[model samples]
Target: RFNQFFSFFSRIDTLGLNNFIDPRGYVQIQQIMENMTINRLEIRVDSLYMDLQIQILGLCRKNNIRNVVITVNPGGMIDQFRNKLCTESEFGVTLDVCERIGNVEGAYFGQWRRFWNEMDVYLRKKGIKMQMNLCNDNGFDHDGYARCGVRSHIRCERMDRQNMGVIRPISLSRGFLPK
Candidate 1:
């Protein structure tokens, strides 16, 4: 089913794909991706599949993908953020920085901050460029901000129910992708 689905598109400049799939599907997906001309590939990393993130990174490197944006779910572990596996290409990260705030939120926020900081430092050492964004966990703040100083700028829209995807091109004026 997956191979046939991919056979329909020969080259995709930008695409969004769900990463909440079985590990076995990754190799197949990677093989398909390698044959396409993908300028950018965006994936939302579910916490349940944290281990698969490394494999996805490997796939990106092997395929020589132009740009990759991985939106990591909240409470997700950074143990998969290893340098050796990510030595080839640079990628971006869209993290759920803070969606709710309370006593419990504080602890979670702290944990997320530490996680982001550690990943940030790790990526910096690896010379990998990253783009950071805070998604609603649902929607934007009342002020239409993703968070303090953060604005919702870019989003990848799924084209169909089958997880076929495309990026809704928008202004990247705010310099979200850090240097």
Candidate 2:
């Protein structure tokens, strides 16, 4: 079914699909990629497994897929694992750190702060860029507020430049901040 589905198109400018977790699926995707001309590919994952993420990233690099987006929705602690992300292409990848708005047992900020700090250091050394956001999961009708206890996926990277002020702790680095 996967092969047939992809066989319908010989080329595509953009493609969005779920994460391919199975190893066999990797081969299928490679085959499909060889037979297609995909300018941009987006993979969405709901798992917090860094190993899987690394594998997918490796596959992308192996296939020479330059333009790619990987959206990860970590349902648990991501700091528990120590995974090394290495890439040669600096400008082809973008990392978005999406967080839930509401607090969890009063340790949300502290816990996430540590994760982001470590991630910042690691990714900086690896020359990877990251974007952070506080998203509303329920709907966009709440004026972007968290509703006190609601948990929403924050995707501020999707916002326009004029509305960029809402993303907190904006970095003034050489290549990140807009001039």
lDDT of each residue in 1-179, candidate 1, tens digit only: 76778778777765666555576667767876667666565554444344465666666666556555444434443444444323434343222222122233422322554665575566656655322333433333334333332322222221122322322222122322211
The candidate 1 region of ten consecutive residues with least summed lDDT is 170-179
Candidate 2 lDDT, tens digit per residue, 36-132? 6666555555444556555556556655554554444334434333243333235353233333333454332225546655755665565453343
**Model 2 clash pairs?**
134-154, 135-153, 135-154, 137-152
- Reference-based lDDT, each prediction: 0.44, 0.43
Give the TM-score of each candidate: 0.52, 0.53
